[model samples]
Target: MVIAVPAVALFCAYATASVTRHLRVRSTGFDLGIFEQGIRGYAGWGAPTAPLKGPGVHLLGDHFHPILVLLVPFYRLFPGPSTLLIAQAALLAVSAVPVTRLAIRRFGTRGGSAIGAAYGLSWGMQRAVGFDFHEICFAVPLLAFSLECLVDRRWAAAVAWAAPLILVKEDLPATVAAVGGYLILHGRRRLGGATVCGAVAAGLLIVEVLIPAFNAAHTYGYASGSAPLSGLPQKLLTVLMVLLPTGFLAVRSPILLLALPTLGWRFWSANPSYWGTEFHYSAVLMPIVFVAMLDSPPARSRRWLPAWCLAFAALLTTMLPLHALADPGTWRPDRAATATRAALHRIPDGATVAADNRLAPQLTARCEVYLFPFYPSAALRPTWVAIPDAPSNDPRSVAAREALPSLGYRPAASGEGVLLFTRSPDR
Candidate 1:
């Protein structure tokens, strides 16, 4: 089962890569902007503020964990957005190995394989992998590896395992905290060391946050801007969407319940925009559930359960890409990306442009870029402004647009649901 599933996943990844390559010529979902920005940031040419952001925070060119930084030179060597898509696809597919190992460690080999296969082929994973090279894909394996080490009672191993996950994204600090707490409470002494490791992780996170916050304040002259704080209801809904699958499995299979909150909290608090858009993060909890489900069942029932679960996952996975193909807007290809990419190219390179969407910063690397929820001291300076078209059409977009010019910007270039403006050189 393990061999077959990954073999199938490799084939799927290859096919996905082919499709992405063909589509790359068109205005497409695979945005090279971020990757390009990242490469330039590594080369010390693009905005320094970008490296201070989410996944970019941890990049080390080729010197450090070559795995995470591998994309840097890969993009530099390949010089196209499709390279990023291909890399992401490959990572998602390879992540199946660790995920399968984690599942086997908990449930047994077959159950582990089933969970891994489902995850590898999920539409959400495919789409995310195809679209952008976010840190989430890289984090998945490290998180899984950490869990495997934790479950094995290898505290040193787990700490080593989790380091990469923690480094990949800022939010991962919370995940490390939760998992470390679980380890400590469960009577793992080495968890004491893990806790210390987590504390160090926390400190590093604080630095990442503080650096950006401080910079934003100094540069923009504000500590932070008000975006709608997701109200309690919205927060609750976000939690539910992130945890629904785990919740479903937990009810049917109770032993897996502990892992639900352990892993679910990460999803629940995850950036709301992440919901429905990137499924891989949500799928991260699957191995935990699969292991618990497969382990707790009676021997006879266990035999077929893994198969059934895999079958269900397989069916869903097959349907997602087809659905995406049938309705590009609803599925794999987002129109927003195409429209945004097109708009980015129209703006002159090296022109300063302020934007609400992070995509613009990455795509318009030749231009000076500023992202709102503006951090004050970003190393990059804005000379021009760009706002999402029809900001008033929605509250969030409106808030984003209104916030942009308040920092001293005025309109310059506008079209196709996007607006660009130049910042007053005097200011």
Candidate 2:
């Protein structure tokens, strides 16, 4: 009951925040729309092609996450972006189960519940729920359970749980390799060696062969040249932040090593986004660190740790996305959002629409949506374009808005900073 209650409470909290974000039109096309397109394809038993990425772009080429097909049946019953949002919330919330159960087995029920609540509200999971959905949601629970099995010394079950991680994302093989290393350290040499070798081979095969084969350019799309050595301080700060929730005691346990492969790639990547504490990148790391803290020598001796974690997480929540729940503005859409939604409704079903990033997810369920200013070539130009009339800092958006008239598009609907345009009759 302790485990189930906290998990259910967390689920309700996460689901409400995510669905509200979607309702307020705060979701973006780059992710929600892209994934919806791919998952919708899967729901219909077709290729996972996401036109929002670019016409006929196979999502598998962009990232190897066939595991998303698992959501198809659920999507069929309730079709929309909110489905993905709520599903992600559930996936992340349920991860607290194993973490809490393990803690209870070590600590008492009250102490276990505190630790579970802290893990549920950890900054990493909060940030992931605030952001749009990603393939990482599946990994969060898998890591939690696999690590739980590891702590219990259930070798076969741990390997079984970790094996499917590779199908979740291309980079997860590194995590799988780390799990294998942990097994070897525990003296399961033969099993651990096979796991490490298999993970390495699978990662190479997926990135070097599979992704490229499906890619339009026949090369890995995310192969940014090299890792930059700049920003060492910021990267180190991120590492420190990950440990702080656990009061830094996680460092004593070898189980903390599981987090290194994930941290390593993110810090080494040329992309700065991966280096930060923001977004879904850190969601997977929360479980690893908390579990390590459980295994740490201090966990038993220092009963105060759970209270500290709970207090810290509570303080942090006041500043995170869930904080919006306390604000009056979050409950109702403002005039701009209402008007933008009105303009979006003017777009007919099945038509191709070039929409602003913020408005794209709104129309994706009923329309073929594309990101404005980056729409396809003239012959393939979207039949409609919708953007906010309010000034944008992005130069491309500014130029695209100015060029709309000259490009033979006329305002079909306009109000409260929202504009919807369509091709002129004679054009």
TM-scores, all candidates, are 0.61, 0.97
lDDT of 1 by residue, 1-427 (tens): 5644763665465446534533433322123454445555554544323422432342332112224455666766765545655665665566566556655655676666766666565444555544445556666656656665655667777677666655564545555665666566667757655665765566454445544443433232222333334344654564443334332443454334434443443334435543333434554554445434433445565456556656665666555542344445443665555675677676677665555554453443465444533421235446655555653555656665566556556776666566766556665
Indicate which candidate wins on TM-score.
2
Model 2 scores what on Cα lDDT?
A: 0.88
The TM-score of candidate 2 is 0.97
The candidate that wins on lDDT is: 2
Candidate 2, RMSD to the unseen true structure: 1.5
Task: Give the Å shift of residue 34 in candidate 2.
Answer: 1.0
Clashes of each: 16, 0
User: lDDT (CA) for every model shown?
Assistant: 0.52, 0.88
Each prediction's RMSD over C-alphas, in Å, is: 7.5, 1.5
Residue 91, model 1: Cα distance from true site in angstroms: 2.4
Question: Which pairs of residues have clashing backbones in candidate 2?
Answer: none
Q: Write the per-residue lDDT of candidate 2 for residues 1-427, one digit (tens) a residue.
A: 7788779989998999988888778999979999999999999899999888888999999999999999999999999999999999999999999999988877779888989999999999999999888999999999999999999999889989999999999999999999999999999998899999999999999999999988999888877745757678889889998999989978988989999889888887888888888888999999999999887446364568888989999899998988787888887757766766776787899998888888889988888888888863465678899887778999988888877777778888878567888987676
